[model samples]
Target chain A: MTLRRRFVLVHILPIVLIGLVLFAPKARPGLRPCGALLAAAGVIELLFLAALARRKRAVEPATAPCDTVTLVWALLTGWELATSVLHLAHPVLVPAPENVFDTFREQPLVLLRNIASSLELLAIGFSIGLALAVLLGLFAGWIPRLRAFAYPIANVMAPIPAVVISPYLVSLMPSFRSASALVIVLGVFWPTFLGTINRVTSIEPQILDSARMLQPDNRTMIFSILLPYVLPGVISGLKVSMTTSLLMLNFAELMGATSGMGYYVQNSITYANYAHAVAGIIVIGVVVTVLNALITKFQKFAIRWH
Target chain B: MNRIECAHVTYSYEAHSRRETVLHDLSFTAADGEFLCIVGQSGCGKTTLLRLLAGLAFPNGGAVRVGGAPVTGPGTDRAIVFQNYTLFPWMSARKNVMFGIAQARKGLSKAETAALADEYLEKVDMLRAADKYPYQLSGGMRQRVALARSLAMDTGILLLDEPFGALDARIRGELQRLLETLCTGEKQKKTVIFVTHDIHEAVFLADRVLYMADGRIVRELPVDLPRPRADLCCADADRLCAARRELLGWFDRTETEVQV
Candidate 1:
C-alpha cells in the first residue's frame, strides 16, 4: 500500500483504544479506572504517527512507520478485545489492559529501578565481553598457532547456547551478579570473537600489500592496520551480539536475581500480578528498541568508509 | 650501481592446494631517476614483478635489490600504488596520506602530517577532496589519493601496478598527465617501476618500456620522446609514433599503431 493509505489505516489503533475508554462495559468488578490511561495512549500513538509521517524522508524508510504501527495497533486491539471489552481471557493469566497500565501508575519506582539494574549489568557485561573478544581475536588471528587453536575452539563453543549452561554457571559463581554478568559475557563473546578472527585472516591481499609496503613495525601493524580493518566487521555484528546478550542477562536474572526487568516480571508472576508482568514485558521491548537505535548511530560514525 | 634490481626472481602461490608460478626467473634492473614501464598482456606476471620490487612478496629463489642492498622486506624507502584499494577506505584522503607519512617517517607531529598530506593532495589536484573517504571519492579520485599518499611518503622509488588501469579514458588521460608532471617537474627525481598492459601508456610515460610475456621480459624498447608527454602526445608526432610503433612491434601487433 502507498504510505498515505498505510498511514490512514493507522487511525484504527486510536479508534479501538478510545472505544475501550468510552464504551468498554463495567462487565467485570475489580477492573481499575482506566479511562485516562487508555485515552492518553490513543492520543500519544496518534501524535507519534503524525510526527513520524512528517520526519525527513532520509531518516528512515517511508513505509516502516506505517507498517510497524499498524501491526502494533492490530495486536493491541486484539488484546483489548480479548481481555477488556469481550472479557474472554482468563483474569489471572491475561490481565486486562486497564490493570496492566495501572501497574505503571501504582509503582513507577519498582519498574524504573529494575530497568536501571538491567542497564547497569548490560553496560558492564557487554563492554567486558566485546572488548576482550576483539583484543584476543586480534592476536589469535595474526599469529598462526593461536588462529589454528582459536578457530576450532570458537567453532565448538559458539553453537552451544549460553542459556543451556547459565544455571550451572550461576551455581558455580560466588554471587548472582557475577553469574548474571558471566551469562551475558558468554552469550556475547564466542560469535564476535570468531567473527573478528575470521575477518582478520581474510583481509584483501591488495589492502594487505599496501599496508606491508608502509613497513609498519609489529605494534603498528597489529594496532594500527589490523585492528581498524577488523573493527567495521565487529561493529556491524554488534547488534546481534547485543540482543542475544540482553536475552541472556534477562534469563540469568529470572533465575536468582532480586532486580532487573526480568526480575520484575518474575516477581510479579510469583505474586500472581499479571498486570505488572505485562508492563515489564513492554519495558523490555522499549529498551531493545532504544539500544538498537543507539548501535545504528554508532555504526554510522565508526564505519564511514563503508 | 642500479637503483633497483631483480636477479632471476621467481614467485608462486598455493591456490586450492596447487602451486601456480606467476613469475619465473625474471631479471631486470632500473637506473636512478629512470622511468621504466613493464607492458604485457593480462596474467603475464607484470604486477607480480612489481610486487617483488615493492617487497610485498619474496622470491622463492634469487633476490630483489634496491640501492645495492637486498630487499628483505617492505621498507619506507620504496612506496607503492596499486590500480585500486591502496587507500584505506575508513580514512579520508588526507588521513590516508597522513598515515603514509607517519609510517614512512617517524615522529612527525599531527599538524606536520596534515600539512604534508595537503601538500601532496594539492600536487595531485585532489586537495578539494582531501577530507573525503575512499567510498565518497570516485575511482580516479581514489587513485589520486593513493598517488598522493605514496608521494608524501618521500620514497626514493615508486612501484605502481597499473594505477590508472581501473579509470576511464578521460580520467586516465588526466592522471597520466598528472603523474608525468609530478615525476618530471620535481628535482631529486624518483626511480619508478610501473607495470601496465597499455602499450600507449607505456610509450608515453617511460624512458624504457619492457614488453613482458610468458612470465619474462620478451622485448624492450627505448622511447626518445621529449618531456611533458601531454603536449608531446599532440605535438611531437614523429618520435611518439615511432616509439609506440616500436612497442607494438614488441607486442607482435604491428598493424595496431598507436597515435601520439
Candidate 2:
C-alpha cells in the first residue's frame, strides 16, 4: 500500500474496531451514540486522507522515514471525534481530545515538576549505572582474572528481572522515587554491561593486535582504544536501554509514586477520572517518542564512522 | 647497524586444532639498507618469516633480532605493508599516513605531521586521494596509500608481505617499479624484507633473493646488479631475467615433489 493509504488505514482501522465493539453491545444505552462518534472519526480520517491525497505528488517513497506530525495529527483527530463531538459511550469514560490538550495547560506547573523530577532521576541513575557497566565490562573483557570473577556474576545477575525486586526495594528505600530510579538503573545496566563485554571481546582481532603493538597500558587501552572501538555498539545499545529504563520507571511508579507520568495515570485512575487517565497516557506516549527521536539524532552525530 | 637477524627461528599454528609447523629453524641476516626478497612456492612460510621480522608473531624457537635487540613486539622502527587491508578503512589517506607519523614522530607539531604525510603521499603519486577513504579508492590506489603510510613512519626496516599480491599483473608491475624508484632513489636507504610468490618480482626489485621450500630458506642468490633497474630495457635486465628463471626452476621442482 502507498504510505498515504497506510497512513489512512492506521487511523481508519482503530475507529472501525471501536465501532464493531460499540455495536456489539446492544444493551449498553450510552454506547449507541458511539456509532455516531465512529462515523465522525471516519469523516475526520477521510479528511486526513484527502489532505494526504492532495500532496501525494510531493510524497517520497512508501518506505521513507517521515516526521511524526502525520501520526500525531491522526492520533489527535481520532481522539477529538471520539469523545467531545459525538458524546459517544459513557460520559465519564470518554475524554475529549481538547480536554487532554487542556490538561497540559491546566496543570503545566505540576507537569513540569513531575517531568523534571523523573528526568533528574534518570540522568543520575543512568550515568552512574552506564559508567560502572562500561568500566567493569572493559575490565572483564580485557583481563582473564577479572573476566573469571565478573563473567559468572554477570550471567547470574542479568536474568533477575528488575520489576520483580522493585516493590521490595521501595519498602527498603527512603523514597519511592529513589527506588524507582534504582529499578531503572538496574533495568538498563545489565544488558549494557553484557553488551559492552561482548563488544570488547568480539572486537576485530587485527585492531586489537594493532593496539597491542603500541604497548599502551591499561588506562590507554580502556580510554583510547576500547572505548572508541565500542562506542558505535554502545550508541546502538542506548536506544534499547532507554526504552527499558522507561518501562522500568513506569512499572516502578505503578506500585507507588507521588509524581510522574505514571503516577498521573495512577492518581486519575484512583479518582475514577478516566479523562485525566487517558490524558496521562497520551502525554507519556508523546514524551517517550520525543526522547527516542532525540536519542536517534544524538546517535547519528556520535557515530559518524557508521 | 640496524640489521635484522633470524637465528633458527621457527613458527607454527594450530590447524584443525592440531599443531602444524609452517616454518622450521629458519636462519638469515638482512644487513642495514639491504633489500632482501624472499621468493617461495605458496605455503612455504615466506610470509611467516616476514611476520617474525616485523614482530607481528613470536617464533616458536630461537630468536629474531634487529640491531642486536630482540624483537618482543611490533615497534616504530619497523613498519609493515601487507598485501591487503593494511590501511584502516575508517580513516582517510591523509589521516592514515598521519597516524603512522604520529607513532614515529611523537613530538612533531601538527603542521609538520601534515606536511610529512603529504610529502610521502606525493611520492607514491597518491596526494590527489589524500582526503579519500580506503574504500573510495581502487585496489592499486589503496596500496599506494598503504605504502605512503608505511614510508611516512620513517622506519629503518620495512616489511612488505606480498604487497602487490592482490593486484592485477599490470598494476603489480607498475607498483613494483614505483617501489624500486622510491626505495633506491632516496638518499636515506632502509633495510627491506619483501616476500612474494612470484620469482620475477623477486628478481626485478631485490638486491638479493632468498628462496624457500618446506618452511626453510634453501638458497640465497645475490643480484649485485646496478641501480636504475628497469624491467623492460635496462642493461642488466637480461641478468635479472636469468636469475628469475633459476628461481622459477626451484618452484617447478617443489611443484613436482608435491605432485609425487
RMSD of each: 3.3, 5.4
Candidate 2 clashing pairs? none
Residues A1-306, model 1: lDDT tens digits: 666776677787768667876686746556888853675476558757686868797876666666666776677778778877888889789887788888878888988999999999999889998999998899898889989988999999989999999999989999998988888888888888898899999998899899999987878878888999999899989998899988998998898899999999999999998888989998899899889989999999888778
Model 1 segments beyond 4 Å from truth? A1-9, A43-47, A54-64, B14-19, B233-235, B253-260
Can you write out model 1's per-residue Cα lDDT over B111-206, one digit (the tens) per residue?
A: 999998999999998999988989999999999999999989988898899999989999999999888888755594789888998888988899
- Docking tier of model 2: it is acceptable
Error of 1 at B200 (Å): 0.6
The 10-residue segment of model 1 chain A with minimum total lDDT is A35-44
Can you give the TM-score per candidate against the true fold?
Answer: 0.93, 0.82
For model 1, the local distance difference test gives: 0.86
Per residue, candidate 2 scores C-alpha lDDT tens digits across A1-306 of 766676665555455445444543333222223443444445555755555455656555433223343464556555545555455546667765445455665676887777776677777778877888888888888888988888888888888998899889989899997888788778877877888888899987656655554445688678767887778888888878887787778777787788887787888899987766876786677678778989999998876645
- Model 1, position B32, has a per-residue lDDT of 89
| Residue ranges of candidate 2 with Cα displaced over 4 Å | A1-102, B13-17, B89-91, B133-137, B169-171, B231-235
